[model samples]
Target: MSVFGGMSKGERNRIKIRVRTAMATQTQVEGRYLGGLATPGDGSPLIDAYRRH
Candidate 1:
């Protein structure tokens, strides 16, 4: 079973947005300092995109 199977779609989406926002913020900070750190997951494309907004 999916780990989030019991969650409603809205709940899952909310979680995803929250996580994405946090990651995006982190990426922004790292980018400012030119820190060569790798994010924990899938790099930071989502985060980088979000920062454009």
Candidate 2:
């Protein structure tokens, strides 16, 4: 079964949007600063992305 099988269409769509936005932001940051992609030595991507301000 699909992972989203139990979710409503709207819920799944919202998740897609969030994932896309996160992925785009991650790619942009990685390219501009981290040299195109996340490296193992760079540490956690999620933690770097959602840092406290």
**CA RMSD (A), model 2:** 10.0
* Per-residue error (Å), model 2, residue 16: 0.2
Pick out the ten consecutive residues of candidate 2 with the lowest summed lDDT.
31-40
The all-Cα superposition gives candidate 1 an RMSD in Å to the true structure of: 13.6
User: Candidate 2 — which residues are off by over 4 angstroms?
Assistant: 1-7, 32-53
Off-target runs (Cα >4 Å) in candidate 1 are 1-7, 32-53
lDDT of 2 by residue, 1-53 (tens): 56567567769899999987887898788753534555567584444656677
Clashing pairs in 1: none
Per-residue alpha-carbon lDDT of candidate 1 for residues 1-53, written as tens digits (9 for 90 to 100):
56567567769899999987877888788753334544757565434644656
Q: Give lDDT: candidate 2, residue 40.
A: 68
lDDT for 12 (candidate 2) = 82
Best by TM-score: 2
Per-residue lDDT for 49 in model 1? 41
Candidate 1 TM-score, C-alpha based: 0.43
Task: State in Å the error of residue 5, model 1.
Answer: 8.7
